[model samples]
Target chain A: MEIYNYMGYELIEKIRSKEITIQEVIQQTYERIEETEELLHSFVYLSKERALKRAKNLDAQLKNGKTTGKVLGLPIGVKDLICIKDSPTTCGSKILEEYRPPYNATVIDYLIEREGAISVGRTNMDEFAMGSSTENSSYGPTYNPWDLERVPGGSSGGSSSCVASGQTPISLGSDTGGSIRCPAAYCGIVGIKPTYGRVSRYGLVSYANSLDQIGPLGRCVYDVALILEIIAGYDPLDSTTVDIGVDEYTKELNRSIEKKTLGIPKEFFGEGLQKDVKEKVKKSINKLEGLGANVVDLSFPHLEYTIPTYYLIAMSEASSNLERYDGLRYGKMSDDLKGDVYEVFSRTRGERFGSEVRRRIILGTYTLSAGYYDMFYIKALKVRTLIKKDFQNAFEQCDAIVCPTMPTTAFKIGELVDDPLQMYLMDVLTCPVNLAGLPGLSIPCDYDNKGLPIGFQIIGNYFDEKTILNIGYQLEQELNIYRKIPPLTIRGN
Target chain B: MSKKEELSKETIEHISKLALLDLTEEEKEKLSKQLGDILNYFKKLDDLDTTNVKPTTHPIDGLKNVFREDIPGESLSNEEATKNAQHKKDGYFKAPRILKE
Candidate 1:
């Protein structure tokens, strides 16, 4: 019954072979959630009735010799941002606390219909996907399953923590900047931020339109690859999705990384990067070199400019995108609607939205406001072009780029929650990838001396997720970190 | 780094208004300092010379004006669309008064 620790693919095969019924997996999933949710607090809403119904249906269909679909009989924890039909999809904000989405996100449609994935629940996240740690959530921070005192890097912290703690075998998360990768690194799991136009973003609550992407997170490269292949591809519903074909990611995962060139960005190893993270990442590079991949030193000259460039661009878009949230439709409303529309809008947002959400919106409005737009927003945009060019040059000399997914391991839960500037700075390593709209994967490389996980980031050229995935898949065979489970799960069970 | 980035209290007031958020005195006071520091941090972008470099609005190239056949598609029903509304009347998302009395 402790099948929670099994890989997603293994669970699917076990169900397919009749070694275990789908009911057993579903029962175990809820049981795991029930056991640890008090401390982990990873899930915001548990979809018990609906998930059980789907599990029973899938079990019946299996008995009838009609298979569901590459399926996971196990649960997949969906981030609160992605809409699920009639499901409470609050992006960890109280503003939309009362609202339930009427339709499923395209990824949800694909996940349920194409892959037979069950939703254990909607995972927790930073409110409006604004913070680096999951502490900004209205429901409360999702404690790091590895170290309860520490954070699970967010805004996908809940998704990452759930997988790490064995509450779910896999989870889906959206990354605008470092939401997915940071948590993956912190919680010792695998996560991908696919190219911007690679996956459908429809029904995902937009934080920043241009920067946001929905991706998969799991305990291993294979779990992530399997989920990515299922959710990827063009859908007419999401025009931002590319018409290009998605690779056979799970099939293409086992290819050798021999002769592949990896670029190590010199800027990534510079100041403020923790000593432990640097050493662990450097050791990972040597492992890759020993595995037949070539490692080359490179520099992204405009790298430091990325923080400002990313924030300026992201905040401006967030301000514009969030304009639709007025009291009248889809969320908690003000009691007094007698005031003018502006009063109503302002009061609702002020009362409902959390502090971090307010700060982003306020700063976002300032950057886009008169007299400042050219100096801040426009300048940031042009610098975005230069950052893109930097990656373009690096990719020419190397097949992929590797760096520490985060500058440091997961800090204590309350460590960086205050000091907004400090929290924003934590995203320096990951946001630059979003600026270029490239595919980036974070795999557990090595552990710091503190017994915390360190994530190794493999960033790929646009639309080239397969190479990075293959590299991660191959690297794990040598390091063998995926099979390791966090002690927290064992203790909790 | 030539000059410190600072947000004037009045400017923060104006921004809060533009963003349409009613603010507490504490929020304005806190944001005035926090945002100024962030804007100061953002000043790092000025060091780069982006002369003639086109801004990347969206990362992918040749990804605009996606043309599909003009046709009616399955759209959300009125009830479904109004389902999440805080205030709805007659299958419509009812809103607060736009004009002051």
Candidate 2:
């Protein structure tokens, strides 16, 4: 039987039934990783010994009849930005080439301790999760599993690619302005960006702290829901995390989406969206309506300003959050400094961070600088208040907002490399959700004539993750469109 | 386009210096051009009716500060602190000799 076709629940049941061993599953996972990793470049770091040891322990526990969690023995891929104990948390940058954390992130702890999930490896990402494309990684860009010449959408590109390719059934990814969903969309998988504070950010290397959130990516909606259950919760280490009660996400999967309302915001489908993406998303919306969802035309007038507002606020937060990576503290040190403390600091930073990171830092610093503060940073904050208010108004009228996850599908790796602004604009549709701190999900809606998968985005009110996933599940049953398999380049079988 | 926000090489150097990044002359020139282009684009917003539009800082609901207990908590020991340091001496990192003659 193709056990990989099953959801987290069935996969766990098979392990318990003696039909499969965690060791066998993990070996399959590693074999797949080894097969596809060269083309996908999904991983920044892989721990063969650690993963095998964990698998062996899980197998022993199963043999002893000690199954204790939902994701028993499932192998998961982790984005590099989230720290895993003793693993190199490079954040896709060369500066932290040797930096290893003394502790696991709260999510890592949750996945390993509370839930018995084995980690396959750390996935590659954009440097500091700054860019929309995985091409910005200092290690090298991870290619889309669907097409080797194309990018796996980023900065969670690696996570999405690994999941899509079946290297792992599920993976953890962080979303700040479409990092998770965009890549998931491009790679033809399900990706969710939970409401801000829904998942603890304690051990996540900060990108845009306030907007950044940790979520999951999978080939299907059920797996996405199960993984979210494992990782979502409050952590005392992170004050930003809310102390919310965890829900049985898998149970919500069975909830019917008969009478739920889905709002299709007009502004999102405006110009600049590729025609192929529009058709796929529109057809999916119509299908959901056919399946009993009350599809309504909605207006989020401020949607056009989402990208600019997101950039200002995100860059500002990124500027401050990344300030701690001075060579004197962590990361690579510079040897060319000949004078004072200032020289040491400058030389170290210049040599360490990539051009993209430095550009953002400079832009952020300038915006927050003495004279520009009131005009830029403070102004952007006020706009953020308005953006959040827009979501609030929309949620009052509907249960969820549906849109395209990205303006277009994944492009050639070098297509937008020289034009950062164009790359930044690719995150237009999804950034607003991060700005509003709302829950959002991206699911494969259809494959275009060219055979590339297009994703439809569904967003919900704060803490309304269940509604979005239910809608996604219902739509999945109707469309039965899950074509984002890792191409032969990355699939071991 | 008016070049009001044009960044000079010296200014780029100054920003780089402030940012603690070492840049070769070639990189500085390239970054200067790129930064100039980006700033020029954002300059369009300066022409908008943003006088009434508030700048967005964060996208979350409410703004209440949550504070931790004042009780003392576990701290990292010096051994643990210096365990990963590439350079250290006498419980401190040793830098270049810096006594002015």
Candidate 3:
């Protein structure tokens, strides 16, 4: 059996039952990585030695009849933005190319200590989780496994691509405005952006503090739920985390969503949406309606303002959060420069940061600057409240909302890179969920004529991830769209 | 498109300086045009009357200042903290001199 092709949950069960040694799984994971890494360019760093060592130790523990933790030796890929102690956490930028964290992220601690999962490698991403396409990575763009010339949606493109190509059955990605869902949609995988603060951001390199979240990507909703169950909860280290008890997400995966009301926000289906994508998503919503769900036409009047509101707020926060990278502590530092402190600051930042990062910083600085504060920053914030209220009002009549994850399927690499506005619009459908701090799940609904995958997004009320996961799980069982491996993975074997 | 409003080169330079970013002459020209386009697009917000709405700085509602007990816990040693530093002196990060002699 090709163990790499098994879902994360199945692999764990197999290891727990002693059907396969943990070493065998680890070996197969690396072999799969080797098979597809050249084409996909999914990972920035691979911890083969560490993963092998941990697998061997876990194998010994199992033989000694010791009870392993929940995951029981499942290998997971982590987005490079999340720090793992002593591992390179580049966040896909040249600025911190050699920087390693002194401490692991709270999620990494939970995965290793509480759940017994091994992080196989650091997946590639947009520099500091900034762009829609992985094209912004200083390392290079991660290609979609479906078609090498096309991009894997980003900034979590590497995480989604790794899972889709069978390199790892599960991985973690951050969503700060559709980073997680976009990649999952384009790569034909399942990804969840849990409620903001549902997972700790202590180790996540912040792009925008208020909008960022760490979540899971997997081959199926069940696998995504399992990882979410292990990672979701409050952490004292992150004061923003809500002090609420985490529900057993996996327990509710098989629950029925019968008689539930799903609101299809009419604004999302309007102009610029691809015909094929719109049709596919509508069919999925219809499937839910057939499953005893009441589909209602809901309007979020503030939908058009989401891109500007989200970008203004996110960029403003990012400017503040990124002030720490001044080259004085932990990152690339310049030498042989004869300049004062201010000159050093400008030179270091200008040399190290990429064009996108510099652009956002300047824009953010201008918005928050003296003469324009109220006209730009404050106005954007007020519109943000209106956007949030739109969701609140819509949720009053529905259990969840549905939309196409992206307006269209993944485009060819470099197709939209030059046009930043076109690139920003790619997140139009996904960013509203982040703007309101709600939970969103992206699942493969159908494939386009080019064999590229189309994703359907389910947006749930704040802290209501279970309901959406339940809805996704039911649809997943019926659609069974995730069963097809990307042609690259099949060819590799 | 009617005459679009543009951000001046002076404003871009000032903002870049505030952001501690040094832009090349070419980058400044390119960025000024891009920023002008983006900000012009954002002018759509002017259409809404937000007089009664309160700005939302944080997404979560009803969050107050979280106070933790003043307790000591494990902390990073100086060496561990400075391990990634490119320039360090006497357990401190060495930065370019701020005061000119």
Candidate with the greatest lDDT versus the true structure: 3
Stretches off by above 4 angstroms in model 2 are: A1-6, A335-338, A489-493, B1-4, B44-56, B96-101
The sequence of per-residue lDDT tens digits that candidate 3 reaches over residues B36-63 is 8888887878889999999998999988
TM-score of every candidate: 0.97, 0.95, 0.98
Interface RMSD of 1: 1.2
Can you list the residue pairs that collide in candidate 1? none
Count of steric clashes across candidates, in order: 0, 17, 0
lDDT of 1 at A125: 98
Provide the lDDT at A143 for model 3: 91
Give lDDT per model, in order. Answer: 0.89, 0.81, 0.90
**Model 1 per-residue lDDT at A350:** 90
Model 2's CAPRI class is acceptable
After superposition, candidate 3 runs with Cα above 4 Å error: A489-493, B1-4
**Residue lDDT tens for model 2, B1-101:** 34467778988777665556668898778878877777666554444355576555445546457887799988877766665566678877656445553
Q: A1-493 in candidate 2: lDDT tens per residue?
A: 4545565566777887879898988887788788768878899889889989988988888788776766888888899989887788899997787788877899988987678988888899999998887998999999887778888899999998888887888899999999999999998999999988899998899988889999999888988888888788877888877787978877887787788888877999999999989987898889888888787787887776666678877887877787777665456667675777666667777777888898888878767777777766776666667677778888888899999998888788899888888888898899888888899999988876666779899998888798899889888888886643555442221
Top model number, DockQ: 3
